[model samples]
Target: MLQKIIFIFLLVILVSCGQETQPKPYGELRLEYPKPHYKLFNSNSPFTFEYSDYAEITPAKKKDWYNLSYKKMKANVFITYFPIHNDFNLHLKEAEKMVYEHTIKASAIDTQSFSYPNHNVFGNFYQLQGQTASNIQFFVTDSTKHFVTANLYFNSRPKPDSLAPAIAYIKKDLEHMISTFKWK
Candidate 1:
């Protein structure tokens, strides 16, 4: 009886030891976001644009600065308005400097120039890739009087892969806002 028990225990151990231990494959996380519905943002400020109804717009402490907060995505778009006041170049430099500041962490920065001659709106939209603090930055100005800059920041860690879905969603809203932006 003891010999039979010992033999069975040894057989079980041998079979278990022969089995290969494999690591589970990694899977991507799926995040679903609500379809955005936009509405014209009517503000008493110098300019107006369409914003996603999904986001909550809050007036920043500074004048002409607004925070478009997307709570679900843990992101915020900070929009700042600056009157050119014969300092168009100065404001342009400032905007460029802000975008460049993220270069340390950004893998690449692609800029797209936008022109709306009829509305006198023209500027560069910057898409920053990689683990950067700000994923997107843009500036629109009449090249004379009004200068506006907007930057998108996520409250969480900058993981481009994980944040791709949220980033893409917010990007569409930003593009829409830029397209419909008008000087008030």
Candidate 2:
């Protein structure tokens, strides 16, 4: 009976391990972001991030975006910086339009919505969802006399309930880029 039990346990393990599924490595992601116009330089200011050395930042030539990639994590992080006056409503509207247009062209956004402006960032984040809602996250920023827009894309479905943690992780890197972002 002991031998039979061992055999059954081994069979169960084999069956379970054979299943095909998406691999999500916690605290790590895989993406291919476009490059920024300029190389990022170190700053003494608090607005800097401690990125892993394995990561590379490059400017995206095909599109108007900056791509940051992590070799170790196999993730793509893209950022676009738009410069504008903060107090101008017209500029804000224009920025919003640019972000929406970009999103519409990039993904299948069946439903589009915007959130209240984040006072801290002096901008807002918009969410786009289709049948599966976990594929994209969009943001617009008009901070420090600069209009910055960003989009995070994933091959996986981006339902907030399921992809929230990964989205959160991506945002951390995006935030770092935004904070250190400068136009040359």
Candidate 3:
């Protein structure tokens, strides 16, 4: 009787082991952003520009400093203003140094110069590609009296692949702000 029971159990196990297997499919996450609406940002500071309504603007510790915080994206654009007391070269050097400091982690750095003669708004925009802490940096000046620098930072680990969409969206807003910038 014991030998017969063991044979029956072995047969049941062999019958259950012959099923087919299926492979799991791969997938990617999709992110969508709202159409941007901008409003003119004017303050007691010496400059004015258009900023995205999606972001909240708050005063920084410094007198003329401000932060454009994007809560949904977990990022901020920090902007600082200074009076160029015949130290334009020094300011430019400092801005350039700040941007290049990320070279250790940045795969590539591309720069584009913007000139708005009518508004006296001229600047250099730096875009850093790769897993860098700050992907964007810029400085806009009238070359004699006013100097302004801005940098973009995300509040998370640097992962270029995952952050591409948010970076591109914010970059568009930054470009628009630069184009519409004016010195007051």
Highest lDDT, which number? 3
TM-score of each: 0.87, 0.42, 0.88
lDDT of 3 by residue, 1-184 (tens): 9999999999999998886877878888898989999999999999999999999999999999999999999999999999999899999999999999999999999999999999999999999999999999999999999999999999999999999999999999999999999988
Per-residue lDDT of candidate 1, residues 64-182 (tens digit): 99999999899999999998788988999999999999999999999999988888889999999999999999999988789999999999999999898998999899998989899
lDDT of 2: 0.50
Relative to the unseen true structure, what is the C-alpha lDDT of residue 157 in candidate 1, on a scale of 0 to 100?
94
- Misplaced by over 4 Å in model 2 are 1-55, 62-65, 71-75, 85-91, 98-121, 126-144, 156-165, 176-184
* Tens digit per residue, CA lDDT, model 2, 1-184: 9999999999999988965898986774544444323345453322222343445766676334556665443456565554454565666666466545645434444333332243334445554544332234445443455454555555554445555555555555555544544333
Clashing pairs in 3: none
> Candidate 1, residue 65: CA error in Å?
0.8
How many steric clashes between backbone atoms does each model show?
Answer: 0, 22, 0
For candidate 2, the 10 contiguous residues with the lowest summed lDDT are: 43-52
